[model samples]
Target chain A: MDFGAMVDYLPLFEQAMWLTLRIGWIGILGSLVIGLVVAMITHYKIPVLYQISLFYIELYRNTPLLIQLFFMYFALPRVLGVGIDAEACGMLGLALLGGAYMAESFRSGLEAVEPIQTESALSLGMTKAQVMRYVVLPQAVSLSVQSFVANIIFLLKETSVFSAISLMDLMFVAKDLIGLYYNTTECLVLLVIFYLIIILPVSILGTVVERKLRYGAFGS
Target chain B: MELLGLDVLFKGSNAMRLLQGLGVAVEISIISVVISLVLGMLFGIFMTWKNPVARVISRIYLEIVRIMPQLVLLFIVFFGATRALGLNVSAELSSIIVFSFWGVGEMGDLVRGSLESIPVHQYESAAALGMTKGQIYYHVVIPQAVRRLIPMSINLVTRMIKTTSLILMIGVVEVMKVGQQIIEANRMVSPNAVFGIYGTILLLYFLVCWPISMLARHLEKKWSN
Candidate 1:
């Protein structure tokens, strides 16, 4: 295709990449926090909060992130009578959607810790919170590491949709360039390459980490 | 009251348009799922074959599909192909192509995993009984593999359906696009209509996906035992 056009558009794509990474990292962190809290609530089976967390997870997990983004960006502002910008809406929507998936991952991790481990810790006169911290959380974190990496990648790919809400993410920049110059091939090639640049390292690193964890767990 | 914005849905043909939009989304999902299932099964078998070339090619294909965002793939197929290769692919066709490309990778992996999960002794025993390779797969392996395959593929179907929402970007008038059209048309008359319209669209997707996922979970539980 057109190498010249691609080179000319590099700066715009760079700017968009930074915006995407900034929002993606923040959304990833936000989802991790929300996921951890929700997983804890469900794991401990807290009275009302447990049910609420389950509902939240199910609702978010089942619905499309695009619709969630639309509802937050377009609908929420009208209903709440407050203005929310596209970037903020993108970050918020990603966090909420990613949170549900992360919660499920973490919950499965937490459940994977054997009952005997908790029982032995409890019999040792350790407090419930202490047992959770010392006995359960560490193991659970290790177990959930692979899924966490997966969820992170999933969330980052989802940042592509942020364009719909008018965020100038990589996809937005590519579409904008194509609209202006009709360089669809150049723009799309750049889009795919940039996405691979963002995603491939994480995926490779994830596989390495998962293998290491497997060896560490099984002594194989 | 106008505050809730539910009135907009009842007015004129808004509700009908939404249903039609839902139909388009479902239509794409079903077509893509069918194509992926058949092709992915073959790909899955190829993956399990004892050939280095097939192994390396399948690995690269799977990784590429996994690493690239589906939206970028969609843009490439829908926008780039039209200009670069001078192929006139419609939005719906492009969506099906991208989704099936994605689905095949996912389903192929699922098939390979389930196929590999069946123990070696089962194959040996069937061989000892003098069954042909094709018969072995049809009678012994496939029956067991189907158990694991069903629940996971159901999950994939739900994932594919949810992902069809992305087609709206390429200008496919799917459910999300219809919701946007309704809100834009009523923006002045009912500024709050955005809330109801999008919320309804969200509910519609939830309704479509939730039961299928539930069935998947149920099947996994039942079959696992």
Candidate 2:
């Protein structure tokens, strides 16, 4: 299985892993912001913005992340007449796609918060924006933390697709290693294990967070 | 003007290729969904049953499917499986196998959730009524579980449909692949054609998936209430 070559490639894979992590984290944060915004806009049912947010969520969620990445990498540049680095394109694709799911998660979280809390905050003379920002978003985010984490992991898995656009992510490195070494089995095994290493700890952490939140770790 | 390459759709064989691709995509999604549901149900049953080996096996399968990307799995099934098993398999067949493997994990988890959600009293009452294990499952548990399962399963189906786009990466001539082909063929001739072809592909996917998603949401709402 050319185990020696696999070992020799670890340095390269480590670099690629860093790139993947960089892009994945950027996508996660970007999507969180986008998701929260869209969720809020729609939750309040703003006249035209609500419909636009709904369209954005449905369109992104329904389509494959692969094509979305392609659109960002290939079509967007030509349409806008500008060059975008593969890394930025990959991050943007993941962020946009992740945003849709995040929006749904955030929306559900917003729905989960008791209406009386909002009413009481308003009665206390707080603005709607202030109530949402201070009282509602905290509880809503805590409630949806588990699903939000799962979505993050899903976005991480999706960063693998960026390899198709020639991004120097872990999956792309693994494919390159396979081509260079002609040792498919070892490369594939290493790729799977690499992903497992990244994903398992995050999933365990998600479980712990969910448990803590349920137990009022962040304040009920 | 070119209407931003809208003319490409009315051009030669472009639209036909897309329709054909859509047919293939739908075909793969349907066949894989059916197989996945059947096997996933069995796995779900094993997951809930009181057997150590079965439970462990089911758990491992579920985790692997959940954690791995479908692209990786498709590669493994298409490239790894064929070589390891000493078999010749077409890309479409390989895609179905991979998708079904993923489907089993997802659908099985849904089934497990549905089964677990059934109240304890339901089982106890069935047992008290002199029902055997099989009879209790058939008459008492499954009927109730079906309500939860239907909506969740439909959601999975929509997911499978969207995910099938990944099959093109492994050389399957599905909708996404067809879109790429048309775009490649027209890239130089019409600058706007690239956007136009892909726009069509996106619209096609939205048309197919949006309805299913709406239906699944409707089911979820109806069943939950």
Candidate 3:
């Protein structure tokens, strides 16, 4: 274990961590927005589109993001005759996979809300769209906040997989440093701490939000 | 490029690719699941039982498995484990071990949930009936726990199967890995065909997982009765 070289790679690892966070948050938010929209569309059964939303969520959820990422990286070049950069490719992959899980979480939350609330809103002369926008989405989003956060953490951890197709994330940096220095012990130790530094806050934030939600439920 | 065509899956060679992918996926999933279930059950029992040593060990194992990312674990098991062991352990075997450790901790938590969910009254009734501890566990406790356990375990199995695609990172030629090679080799000819190839691969995973997921849901509903 070369403690000294590991020390030198500290800055590289730090930069990688920052990039990972930036790309991951972008992917997470993008997916959440898309997922919520699709979830709403499906939750109301939206006339004849129930199966489409159901199909979309299922298709994305079951596949590994690695293959999805590959599709974005390798497949698009020929079909569209345009190539995307690695960062964009990574975002697309993560969003596709993450969006699926989020839709389910949001849909379940929407379904979990009592039907009477929707009926009351309907009887109050609110249109379906208005009822959904004002009454349903807010409740579902809030109710699903914990699962959403946990899902984000899960996405963040999985971002490492993007390294395979040359996404310059933290794991890539870790792998590069290990290959360069051949100090497996020291490099991996830094990598683990590097992961913890990012993931720990996420874990804490998720728990606190969940606790708050639980407490609020009891108070009400 | 043409790999996305439906005929590719039916053609002998392409069919072989599909079967190979299916074989690796199921093999790794089954191997990991069996090991994980046994490991999980033991840890679950220890966690529920009043044993100090077992309690501490199980907690630590759970935290480590939960916190460590799957990719890093695979990296360690694939590259580092072989180095550490001084043996030529293949990536596939390493994947099984790594997934087993991960799967076991998750399964153990589910088992723990099922065990604790077994009401205290059930135990007391068994005791009143003059059943021994082992008898109570086998006759009264395990049967009820099995219902909850089955659904969650199956769900975990699907999860493990989907995740085994990650093993491709370490050069495991599962479905995803095979798809990558096909796309790369054909990239010059078809361009952007990787999407369709991957899309098909994604569908293949759904095919593998969806029925099991349905079965899990069915079990949950059935057992709830």
Q: Which candidate number would show the highest lDDT if scored against the true structure? A: 1
Interface RMSD (Å), every candidate: 0.8, 1.4, 2.3
CAPRI docking class of candidate 2: medium
User: Evaluated with TM-score, which candidate comes out highest?
Assistant: 1
lDDT of 3 by residue, A1-220 (tens): 6778888889988998888888888899889888987887887678667788888787777777876777668665756768898888888778878889899889877876677778999999999899888887667667888878868888988888878788777778877867786777676788889888888788878878776665323321
For residues B90-192, write the lDDT of model 3, one tens digit per residue.
9889899899999989998899999999999999999999999999999999999999899989989988988888887788788776766665665576544
Q: List the residue pairs that clash in candidate 3.
A: A75-B192, A75-B194, A75-B195, A77-B192, A78-B191, A78-B192, A79-B191, A79-B192
1 against 3, candidate with superior TM-score = 1
Q: Return the candidate ranking by DockQ, descending.
A: 1, 2, 3
Docking class of 3: medium
TM-score of each: 0.96, 0.94, 0.89
TM-score of chain B of each: 0.96, 0.93, 0.90
What is the C-alpha lDDT profile of model 1 across A1-220, one tens digit per residue?
8898899999999999999998998999999999999999998899999889989998998888999998888888888889897888888889999999999999998887888888999999999999999888888888888889989988998889999898899999999899999988889889988898888888999989887776324411
Model 1 scores what on Cα lDDT? 0.91
Please give the lDDT score at residue B173 for candidate 3.
81
TM-score of chain A for the candidates in order shown: 0.95, 0.93, 0.91
